[model samples]
Target: MPYSRTDLKLEIQTHFDKGFSRDLKILDVGPGAGMYGGLLSEYSDILDYSLGFELDCLEIYPPYIEKFKLKEIYKNVFIGDICTFNISSYDYIILGDVLEHLSIDNAKKVLNTINKNNQKCMVAVPYLSEQGEHEGNIYEAHLQPDLTPEIMKQRYPSLKLLYGNDSYGYYVNYNFNKMKETLVIEYNNLFKKPIKPIYPKNEFKVNFIKGCKFEVIGENKNNYHVEFINQKTNKVIYETDITNNMWTKPSLEYFVDFKIRITDQNNVVWENKFNAENKRVYIHFASNAIGDTLAWFPYAEEFRKKHKCKLIVSTFWNDWFKDTYPNITFVEPGEEQHDLYAMYEVGWHYNEDEDIDYNRIPSNFRKMPLSKTAADQLGLEYREIKPKLSFKKNKSQISGDYVVIAPHASSHAKYWNYKGGWQTVVDYLNDKGYKVVMITKEPMYDDWHDSKLGGTLKGVINKTGNFPLDERANDIMNAKALIGIGSGLSWLSWALGTPVVMISGFSEPYSEFEDCERIYAPKGKCGGCFNKVRLDAGDWEWCPEHKDTDRHFECTTSIKPQVVIDAINRQLEKTP
Candidate 1:
């Protein structure tokens, strides 16, 4: 009755290892044999007496207090039952292996009493242990013998599991501070946890700054000055001089080496630098565009390897890379990302508000190739890395060597606007003993212009219309080459290892992969508008320079069919 289990004692010590750091008062509720009091005294000595605590104890039996030398170990010992004792306020109250001896109703009342003034409390309970009256002491009997972890959680909803195993669990009241908002601490079923919290001071707490947003919290931010700086640039991204109980800010860059410094009223500066090593880091793809996701997905793996952290990734096309990237954990968008040390969102952000935006990249994203933009944002090596696709080649429905062409783009600006360009190329490929297959979702030319420039390409095999990406991938894989605009399908064709003849007047020649046979007509025309202008998603026919004139899409329109035909011929010659 006076001694605690060796394992249970070690578990309780682990809590103290992470819970508090300032000099304060601690009340061990039932220090029957000075088991907890002696442990606390040892910790006080280990931390040097300056930051140690005033250890006290409350015991029902007066004889045990003297027998266990509670008077020598603790500064004060109150001889009374904790259930009926008029408890005074303390910084922390421990009910280690003592709650089961009291009735459920009395235990609840005691917990409510100690939860005043935002006081913190911890409890250690053995779920399956049962004990009768020990040494003829009635108070030592287990009154609530059927208590389990589920029942404890049901009774005290605010108690979060701090550390535990199947036999016993250590829980702490998360409403520890005086602030109205409950402190958030993430816990899972894993053991061998992070040990960073035990080294902080008692004034204010800074939650792990991660996942695009961060929060600095305390009872009040009266004279506090907080600054978040980009370590690499040595520029202060955010600075605040005391206004409220909490301060928060958001960053756009997916990966930023940040240094957070806080100056309290006493001029004591507390600073922390961001590190993702051995921590959980999340990378989210903000775009549903297939090409964009594939372009950026490989960088997630690169980030994981470089940082040596547990990486979590979310993308629209998770199945495409889930099997290929086994080291990364694939999650859905909006799923709860718990206890992340850092998080980054990768996408093309245009027309962002200067006052609030934290600049996701250094310059106009259009200046670099598609995939390199992600590399820049995530602070990785800038190279054209092709993401591996998970879809396998299926049995071909077509009999012979074929050519795939995706003429339609999401916007008309991305289309090959040259009049009758697709028909000429389709005819050219068809006559050259290669079966041309159209893979666009639309069967006819139906964009903002509603022009009849491309309709199943006259004599080619029309495989166009709503097919799965896997099936589309299979068709492209078996084909000799693919001829299309600067769109997602072109990116997919490149990823599938099929040579692509990419035709575009709107974008620069180096906008896509370096190996693609790029066809562009830049003579006497305004071109590369997609990268130059802030794209308006609402406008289907968005020609920034000349939308209403005939030169509206001359970038692609002026691209002669002969140029694309020559590119295709070059690819065929090389592959053959």
Candidate 2:
């Protein structure tokens, strides 16, 4: 025992004060001396009901039982073991210092039975030293083969280990003061299973040229038992263990029916099947719509050398024309459509030519090819070409007196409510003698006024909906620092190698792309909404529960404006 009746009474009183129900039907198992029962009676108004069960009846004498009138507060005081008692009738079951007496095997059996019958049970065990003396009956002390808290948790996955205490000298003081004994509850048998570890999904789309060793990502660190089972023979053909994360090139024949089994120290954890087909290059053609055209340019350079075929890229703008490529050729959309080997139409345009060969196209976009009508209008030849080249760029050159706060996103749902707390951040920075620039789309300024944001400070510039895509990129590239909600602009800022402090509300930080200097997200269940997909299909949206509830985005609200400012200053001070 580690806590007295006074402490227990105070704890119960505190629990009630914090809105715990007074009509709690509590069940006490192995109530050693009925001191706990006596304490519950002191607060008759708060504790509406209680039940006590004891194996030994002599512990609670006639005088102690009469003093509290135990039978009046509770339904019954049964004289029997808890293992046979009906447990569902009560709300809570307290098992105080009773588990250490039983052997490991017997205790497991009792725990299993309790788990099967009860919804929740609180368990208390002594934090026994490596060696300790017990003056009681030899059988009353803990057995040598008793299960510890850690071992018990493994056996019972549904159990949730709650609060525990490790205080000494309380037991001696309890005897001297003639007070109730103390014991710590270390484990609670909850009716729910613990959450399992999250495994990354295997939807990675990789484009690799033939004869080159392309790295397959999204594999966990483990012994991957690689096996190629021939579909024709129904037998295994190749077998090897991939010890490292990187996999080298195998024979071209070995690509078919490739099965990978990843195993840990004890058991197989993941299995993947790779289907082989003729490797076709993917060439994406789009208008100069932001940097969508640039995404496919690097990959085209790599595919041309390996395939030894003419790589033709059709675009609206001639930004890539200056860079000479012996193997690669550039053709405008409508200039020469018939001479190209394959065609890649950007955006939502589709083709209706039924006789066109589909196998030559990229696998991801082949299902819906470009329409012949749209291709004729744009004057572009459709060619399927996959660009291959590692892309790296120099860091953004920051040269400016004021820090820019470009918080505009494409969608309203994607926008952070500046009315909520962003205004506080702008005001704080302004008051500290730092200039602030708020850049946004033109339509946003007409709907919202900056006057409410505590009068415009010195050097405060509001350039709304004016800069074009390239100009916006240049503005971010030259800014002292950029801060905004997670959006395409944030990704663009990252691509420019500019330091960014992004406010990620519901989405997970896109770790694959680099750009985020520091990310601020709402804490708790609603924080990481970026990775989650809703049951109903549409564009992703933030948690509606955070919108208008009493809690009111406390997850986001808790993150102060000063915190973001500190993170930005730290990044500026760091050695590059």
Candidate 3:
């Protein structure tokens, strides 16, 4: 039997691993592309010591000789007919398919000339013959008759036959020395499937869902050992009886990839990679905060254009974005189906002990505002992100003409603490003839303690805690300008295209808004502490004890009330 190139390589490694020294001298009569020699070289690298392929070659084809030179597999190249090539002593010699192209008389002469030493040799002759007339070289056509195991033995009686079969031609020892155990392998069944011909130890990729048929010749199709490995976890996920050609690729509902291996009792026959690239892909948006949600909108716009993906997001800010970005097919968080990437792949793991590489996540998101970072990392072109929200004018949220002031934050640290900060601005705006309307949210308000944020003012429309968030949003849209601390309402003010005077020491202006009047304390290292949200950074430091003192608003306490009053005035002067 004619042995496969891989089968020959495996046999060489298995036999040599048992006893051969680290150094070897090999003769290859025809080493096209060095595929066999390359495999042998790689296997030698894996050994504790090196097995140098100090190789000698006998090939007449000029193109292939140059190809071998490029492969760097052979130590010396001798061009001529093997029949007259200078004979040399060698540790191991490979005939490959060289004998098939020579007349039977010449083939026998070369074999006999080489066997004069009883040196180890591997011989292969194709059972089904083909005149592979390569590159217009008529001399390369097969000229010898097919040689069987019985015939091969009869032709060289002095040579000790180690292994021979109809499928793979034969192996022999010239010295007729102590017989070494020979390794045999066959794969006619697998050859039926149109796998790109490969040397040993190369990977093939397959669809995880549409698996493949793996039936070696003569073995029952269902009798091979199969293994499915989860690539994400690097763990064996499945092992059992395979239905031969009927083995369907298993599904990874949560995981998107795996490494699949097929083997018989002796060795691994084949291996392949299986990833979710073939499956449907879904990108999930799970954050509920309005600002955070909209930040990802630009990413969505570019993602839809780049991939045939399903967008799975909540209805939190649906009205503001649904019409702006129509390609997105929104879904409830629980209803999300992940075929490709998912939010959980990048989220902060709750368990600290679990090792996960955040930088390895395949998404565009990072922990920063849109002004500071791109919405996605995968280089998708997206529209520039500026404060954006779509809504119409509603005058009822305010009485008569007015300027809006929204001054509340979720935490006290983000609260502007300059004494009379808002009150001073309110008095100044009132003096400028612009009626001031200070808006506040419910329950968080209720007490009508206007003095707490700044101070209560007469003639200032105190719409404190009265309007729903929707009404407040509309009111912001209608207002000539809005002034507030760094809070959701400040975000709303900018999103609605209304001019805003944002005051906070916790974050820098460049890190938040693209165009706006930013009032921040610049006196301390604590400036822009909002970006340092790490737990160890301590809750966005605020020296509230110095509220009435000069230290208030960190370094920004020096920004007088007139500064903000003038900023609001300038905004009112502009044409929208």
Candidate 4:
């Protein structure tokens, strides 16, 4: 399955045109023929080096190798298994139409290997369906694995599927155009709105009107005023007072080009163009809560006529929501929450009721399952949110001097206190001439600096809370191996397919989804705390009978530093 030299040149040129200045080393693993190597020879400007490995000697013929001058281009074309080949040095690796020949297990193993090594790669396979049969009478060695975009996504969420062209022999590019476009649109929409205007009711009334018809209708002491103005000339024409909420008939000649501005006790509530000749659409914002009322005002103003009902929201979030979404109607939480056509609650708790009728609640109030009780009431489906971090390969340096020790968790309750084990491990690694880089939060810097164990560690770099989320993920992805407590970073390392040693203090390793090898706290009375909810002091903090007292550091402290170093050595030995 060889692509034409012209097509390969065009692909390389496309990457070059997009400012891909970094050296483009192409790795054609299991290259059936030296045709791809020959294609690279046509584009010397873009191709810095081209290497191919084939299992059979027949694939790399003497004439073919001699014609391309394989040795001169540093082609390194050889006969070997792609599984055994080290691919961390290559910028781009291609596995075209080779997956169908391997067994399902082997295919998975190969994919895992490719993911572990290559930062970016292109994989292509024939579009095979259960009903369809292979048209080509090729070798019997080819065995198809169940392959599709959906299956691939399930196996490798980070590997984006790209459009393939038939001209390239069933080749799919790895570039993610749609996600990039979405990010660009989101960035542009951030600057679309301007700040809103704030004016007092009395100030607004004095600036726009003079006198108006005033009347006290209800128990409230404030008076209702109807001020008249000429719309065409922008001049106050007439004013009057009425005790009841009724309009007074004006002379036909005086009513032409007239408008009315209604003011509340301290602010202008309503304004309308009162043209008798033509009917006009009206929109209003109302809410039970102060926060909801403020948040809905601006959204109502922006899309008032476009919607059938007032754009109502919770009044509690009005101040913050107003800054971003300004045209919504705000309503209070508990005061007979009804008015808007639809309602969206930010934090809704679920109550236990399998057959509760949601329709009984007003269509306006947005229902969301915020709590476990609410989720039960609504029969809402929920999933544990996985850590997803996007990373770009830094080609600046293929290798580095330092070993980063990333330790820190968002919550103290979940974090397993490792005591001084990290320092001990760092001291051991540092003694072997490896610089230690510790990734943690700023608050823990003093803790690490003041420790007696820290004195033994040399060439230590503290990247505590300095790197961005994605960059931090990238750092872990490129690390030799991560040795840390069971935090989100451990989950991230598992997702990235990196070697990790999780220091489980109060949790069990078997409870988590399997991805990589893990070493957990030695099993005892206090182990396997798999309960969904947090436990009380007497309840099963780890086991049913184990009571959490003043001393709860046994799980973390019991695991020796030598044990961690041994685990690291074992993982490093296994990882290619």
Q: Evaluate candidate 3 by giving its C-alpha RMSD to the native, one decimal.
A: 17.9
Candidate lDDT (C-alpha), each? 0.74, 0.45, 0.57, 0.45
Which parts of model 1 are misplaced by more than 4 Å? Answer: 1-27, 30-200, 203-224, 243-245, 248-253, 263-269, 350-362, 444-451, 454-456
Prediction 3 global C-alpha lDDT: 0.57
List TM-scores for all candidates, in order. 0.65, 0.37, 0.48, 0.31
Residue-wise lDDT of candidate 1 within 1-576, one digit each (tens)?
656554444445434544566466788888776666656555433333332446888888887765566777788889888877766767888888888888878888888888764677888787877888887787888887776789888987768776677887778886434321221221122243322112111244343433234444322225667777888889987776754455566444556677777777757567777777889988888999988987888888898999998999999889999889898999999898887777777877654452213366654677778888778778788888888889898888899899988877777888888878888888888788889888877765445323635543577787777899899999999889999888889999999889999988778887788878988875777788766766776898888989999778888877888888888999998785
Give the lDDT of residue 160 in candidate 2: 49
For residues 380-490, could you state the per-residue lDDT of candidate 3 as single tens digits? 444546534556666564565678877766665666666777777877777767788877662233344454565555556767665666788887878888888777787
Q: For candidate 1, which ten residues in a row score worst on lDDT? A: 180-189
Clashes in predicted model 2: 29
> What are the per-residue Cα lDDT tens digits for candidate 2 across 1-576?
211223233333232233224466667665544444544433332333331222112212233234333454345666445545666666556665555555666656666766666544555555442323233324345563334556546654555444344421111001112111221121122222332222222221222222113233432344545544445456765455655445643333111334444455647756545422233333445545433443334444544454454566666544433254555566666665433323334343223753322222222222322222222222234343322222333353333355667665543334444344566666666676556776655433453434333234234576657666665666665666677765556555655666777765544554213335655454453554333432122533344455456544444545566677776776555413
Best by TM-score: 1
Off by over 4 Å in 4: 1-389, 396-402, 411-418, 448-459, 530-550
The candidates, ranked best first by lDDT, are: 1, 3, 4, 2
lDDT of 4 by residue, 1-576 (tens): 222223233343233323233356667654443444443443332333331222111122243344333444334665445556666677666665566656667767766776676456666565442222233313214465456665656655545554343323233334556455654454354433321211111212111111122223221234545656766678766655433334443322111235666565646656755321211212222233322232223333333333333444444333434444444444454545432222223222123652322322211122221122222211223322222223454642225644556555433323444567777777787786566666654434365533423333345675666566556666776777676665556655655567777666555564443444556666663543433333333432333333366445455556677878887777777655
Residue 521 of model 1, lDDT score: 70
Off by over 4 Å in 2: 1-282, 285-309, 314-400, 418-420, 431-434, 443-445, 449-459, 534-558, 574-576
Better candidate by lDDT, 3 or 4: 3
